[model samples]
Target chain A: MTNTMTTRRKSNLTRGQLPKYTPWVVVAAAVVLAAAIMTLVGFSAFGWGVLAAILFTVGLTGISAAVEGARQAKDKLATCLVFGSFLIALLPLISVIWTVLVNGIPGLTFDFLFYSMNGVTGQFDDAAAAGEAPVVGGVYHAIVGTLLMTLWATLISVPVGLLAAVYLVEYSEGGRLAKAITFFVDVMTGIPSIVAGLFAVAFFAVVFGPGTKTGIVAAVALSVLMIPVVVRSTEEMLRIVPNELREASYALGVRKWRTITKVVIPTAISGIASGVTLAIARVVGETAPILVTAGFATSINFNVFSGWMASLPTFIYTQIITPTSPSNPDPSAQRAWAAALLLIILVMLLNLAARLIARFFAPKTGR
Target chain B: MSKQTSRAGDRIFSTTALMAGVLILVVLFSVAVFLLIQALPAFFADPSEITGGEGFWSYIWPIIVGTVIAAAIALILATPVALGVALFISHYAPRRLSQGLGYVIDLLAAIPSVIYGVWGITFLAVQLEPMYEWLAEYAGWIPIFAGPASATGKTMLTAGIVLAVMILPIITSISREIFLQTPKLHEEAALALGATRWEMIRMTVIPFGRPGVISAVMLGLGRALGETMAVALVLSTGPLILSLIQTGNSTIAAEIALNYPEAYGLRLAELIAAGLLLFIITLAVNMVARWVITRNKDFSGANA
Candidate 1:
């Protein structure tokens, strides 16, 4: 019987099975065939890639169906498509970063970081574009304005957001008022940034006369966007504080307020801090609200309550929309790209910091 | 601590918290009321005084159509790819690579809108202009791709593409979370029945994740509807037209952003009214999305 089995043409285990290297071989063959086909027509990188992908998919599916079964073929097709989708989605991200880096690095000079656009005029940009001078002016004023406005926004949003979250998780007990607050907060999250800008404009226009565009106005608009995020995240963090800790505090004769302030908040502080940082990151990049609320200023302004401000987002917007030198837009474009790079860096750093804080500061679960 | 002191502290603390909660409600209420008050002038303004020289409805109608068309384009383009990406992350990707992929997508979301706008006008539009020309040449019979492609590559179609890229991460992340929430037992059961991976996912995961995917798409729709900077910077605004390849069709958010800086008197109010319309539209979309999410919360395992 063993001799007969050994002499058999095929084993049961190996029947209808493709080798593990089948896909790689198929892909390699697809690439060669795709290239030959493309050469016969017009060879373009995009066309070659698309053709290779198509050939690979069809070839693999056909081979699998012939060797294995339709089910395995279908599974292979789905896997290919799913993986293809991921690669396609990644195209824009990779392109965006590549474009930014290539275009932004040249313009991101020391002068670009330090000098304000206060005295810099079209002449300067024109001269720079003509290679008569280095690219003049910088994002200093815009950076200062962004920092000041964001600081004020954080100051306004955090206390209110934290307290509201505390109320939702600790005091509301899912009551009618709490439900209403929770619902509205969710609604607030959906408010368009432009609409938030309009709200600030309308609110301040009614109070402080017709036209009041200042850093504070922009800060208020940002807080409108920032508050809901803070409330939602803080509320989640506070809710997960493990009821035992609060109960223990209560058992120790600590008051509700004291228990929350001492035990609950301390436990969830990491999450709350990270949430706040993310909120800041979110609002820092907002353009529409700042554009409408703070208007635009070429010069640096320190006063959030009074003068107009130029944020990094609006700076990039205005530079692109209405370049400093319409006659020679290269320098303006360069500056705009550099500012964009800076803004992206700021946002990325904040995101990284938030993640690091969340990972490192998580409370130990050990008893 | 003394009982009276403790009582005072508790009263103060709880009341302060309650007041903060109430303040949020008040702020939200005021946003609507204040916008309404500002927009009332446009509603009552003379018919000929509005932008279209006809009526407020006529003035706003084209932009509304433009906004809806842009958002629809974004939603249509992003939904399938986003679902694929979500499935790739939650199911197809190797275990160790999934979390890193999630972060990469989140990074896409982290980039500011203005940078997207800049990239759109400078890079994406330039890259797509040739394709738009090719489409206009070959597909001119299709009304949407009709001839006379944009010279600057700044058209509604281009803006829509940029918007698609912008909203992709939102849809992907939300859908990824929901897809990951599919019950392992159901997946295993489907597999145990000799089903393939695709069949298992189709039978178990897709059904469970349908509501989540819908809500995710809706949220992305809301975002695309209100996205301002990208459309404003990318689209070369003109009156509404059927041909998306043309340099026409302006969205509400883009219109408001471009005009608000120089606007005064009735123009400002008109823009504010436009903003009100945008606010209402997004609000409705988001509310429905949230309602869908909350309704499915019990069985979705999303919250868990």
Candidate 2:
């Protein structure tokens, strides 16, 4: 008993009064109790279930407080809460990727990738009766449509937004016109995707009479969304360009316009490129605007000036909402999921490419 | 003479750039004006014939109320978690862990809004129904969570949750940058003073980063206010209502999207009016965000 007392004293001296463990013990016992109670009473009552979960967590913390010290246990409780919130944030994202991968994998066969949706039935009975391979559909048309529309949107938005940024940062000198442009661009930045679609529809309707829908119209609508992001990001990049560079170019007898075009733009090109790419990525996922302006078509239309074209977003929407083969929806859903997966892949690639472009083109500082 | 001609050419180039900038502005103003002008006739027309009604208040009041309630709920629920994540990334985590976590958080931002809607419908709806029922039964005193459940699983609460998820990444990322830039000297001073870590964060770090946090919230609010896909996907079509459990009430943008295709006569015009209202709210929110961001000098990580 004397030796044990001495040893305890030594431990207390070394470890600052041997942290209290009673709270932690209590917490543990409470948690076990809560869990047992919860199992006894099923989770059908969400209120009671959530309450039990909370009690369980709290009980664990109390147990830690008893085993460890109150302070250390509090810290542990905080760590758990932070980690829990992080997991809560992550749950949806992980579930999405997992679901898409699992559902999309079945439709990712070589034949599925190569074939078109020309003669596919979404019927399970048909598939069973045939004693053959499952029917297939292709995203080739959607892939092409997405590419064409994105290209057109890029063409329309880049020059306009770039020039506008130039005017705002370089020439306008915070003039009233520049401020007005700034205010409006800020407004446009917040414009709903659907409203942009409506604007494009109305604009095209005015130009091509009442009922006008095509890929070009969709491109215009997307530009309405894209331009604001491009303008904002480019303006920010250009504003960050060192004034010394523009002055150096001017000192070398370069005109103001020449200085802006050659030196200022080049200096900020890397950021501008990434910004423009992000803008594209931003709008490429847009469904409502495309649905409003482009309308849907099952068949591929190469020409933007034609009757109808199907972008990937619209295709996904139609496939999910109104399956042509309603008797069985698995195939249609498979196609939609594949297209959705493809869209996510495309955006991810664009983002990666943007990063690469930024890194490669960013101006290097020399010693 | 050649020099003078060249001067004219320089003038033309700058002039063209200026024209392009102004043209963009005009296009924006025109969009706002066009929507309001188209929708005005419906307001002046007979009330009995109008979809929502002719009284200016009747036409817009329901949607406005619904939009505000959902946006507010989303903003409230998301802001704290976003700030916590931002703090974790900026202050708490180790360097490599923070970097990896940052990328994961940004990945959340990259997922399309429509996918969230799809997930909400297929997965979350079935899972959350019991919780919803409980809220209705227990928290019915709070009118927001009190309403009849819909057959379609599209509830205002669901829409609000999706909007929260949509804005979470934006808020977290922006606030992370802000929190990361908090003045080093202040934090070091608090540490040297033998203050506890939480106390230090509360007293020194937050005060310094407050404006940036506010700006981040404002930016998130703007996105939430204008969010179309998640709202359009989640909302059922009906007059806007206050009940979170009820599924049919729509926001301004969602209403326009649903009604625009088949709308005719004055109905189309009223939809435009609804669009106008959304435009105005979004413009105000963006302006406030921009103003806050511009005024907050320490927010840019210049010192860092």
Candidate 3:
């Protein structure tokens, strides 16, 4: 009987069956003990010490019990870590949105939306003394400049990036030239945004005389930053087009270029559009590049080829860095905050529009 | 058939298409070369005109080191957080909850870097000061945490942290997609063999997702390394300090942004050369990431 009993105990250990509640018990004990220690150390603000103690005890008990009875301890730890990270990530995001919304709202009213910094003197004095009331200056010029510059950048990047993708996907068949292009595009994708800004500034400085700061140069700099993104994204989308589709078009006597234009692109148009939109959004709010290349301006200028032009990003940067009204800095900060909010809203709108376009234009599949 | 005319047409069409593509590539290439030459005009100029009295090696080396160190720290801090978030979205959370969380994360990605900069300055500075102070006070033994603290928050640590936040969403989204693509058969086998959920994730899921995660991290690293506006806003450009927590160091991009406007002649050229160095760094990062993705060792079955 003694020999049989010893063998049975050995078998049980080998089978990996243990008490389910073992881990949970330990966990609970540790938590309760930690809470006790915290309480001893005088950390009872908002009953946090007590709460931590309780949670610790409960979690430990649950984990031990789970191991003893259910063998589910593995998932419990992962769940804890995941939730912890989620909350940690949420902290800055929530803080940023809340802070911007709260601080920026006072200056986001109608008049503040329409006016410019033109002729505005001191922050508090200007707002109060302006023929209108408080929060008088708007981001109208900045808004226009941002739109015009971004539009020009889009024009320059899309054709080049798209055509390059086309050559890689439809034409090259993985030839030497295609490989070279691929390598270079990858390299180009990593080009520093500030370097792109520096390039634009230097190029124009040489061509149009030194200290030549114009909105067009800024647009070109933005294009340099944008093209790589467009190429990579577009290339991926094009690559996903079914080879069977291309073959089917070839079988139908459609010329290669014509087939690509009519079939492959149409099928990928939704993705291409979404990708382009994302690339635009990526570079739209670049402040440093703009500051370096385009410089900042208070009044709006429509022409991209000449003079200083205001953009929402530079506008926000200048307002915060050098408050218009030093005496009453609060109003200037308020305007800066408002501009930030507007920029965020603009990005969100672009995202939403892209999603809608994607859904609407996505190729229909029959039921 | 008019063979001569047809040949001429073919030649013209091919040449034109080739020229267009070649021109695009050339323009891109010139951007890099032109900046280098522009930045190094001191090489072309009289030695007397070089500003800052420093030799070529002295000036460029510190900035390169600063950029690399900050980017590495940012990647290290961000990787685990990104993986955790990715796992949460792909496997741990309920479907609807995960969807909502994912949307919020993407929105974070969409918010521009400048906004991050402004927020970093006004809010993060005040909020995170205590932590910075605590480090400086206690960990002063460590060179990085040891420093004369600035009243306004601008440091390598702060820049790294801001970069961490900036790249978190991107890394999480990509990693999540890769994790979700782990072969169901492999996971089910692990589960059926008495592996717990977390065990299944660790052994089967993580192994499958490794390459994808690596590429995502590389991409994030690339962005963090080359990031401009965010760094410019958060950092106080100065000579290199041994400690990361000490305020006053400059990354290559921040250096270019800060000094590009005032620099002239050879000084301007030197800045451009600095830009060329930055370009090379980014290019290496991008190429490595691309290679990682193409290896097909990770996340290959996910798309299927």
Among the candidates, what TM-score does chain A have in each? 0.95, 0.83, 0.81
For all the models shown, what interface RMSD does each have? 0.9, 2.3, 2.6
Candidate 2: list runs displaced more than 4 Å.
Answer: A1-79, A110-136, B1-9, B52-59, B134-152, B239-242, B298-304
Better of 1 and 3 by lDDT: 1
> What lDDT does each candidate get?
0.93, 0.77, 0.79
Model 2 chain B, poorest ten-residue lDDT window?
B295-304
Better of 1 and 2 by lDDT: 1
The two-chain DockQ for each candidate, comma-separated, is 0.85, 0.49, 0.52
TM-score of each: 0.97, 0.87, 0.86
**DockQ value for model 2:** 0.49
Off by over 4 Å in 1: A1-9, A12-14, B301-304
Per-residue lDDT tens digits for candidate 1, residues A65-156, read: 99999999999999999999898889889888888899999999998888889988999988888889988889999999999999999999
Alpha-carbon RMSD to native, per candidate: 1.7, 4.5, 5.1
- Give lDDT tens digits, candidate 3, residues B1-304: 5656555654554444465456568867788777765766655655455555656557778889989887988898889988999998898889879888898888888888888888888888766677777888888788878855665667788888889998899799989988988889999999999887788898898998888899999888888898877787788778887877667778988887777657776677778778888877887888888788766743487566
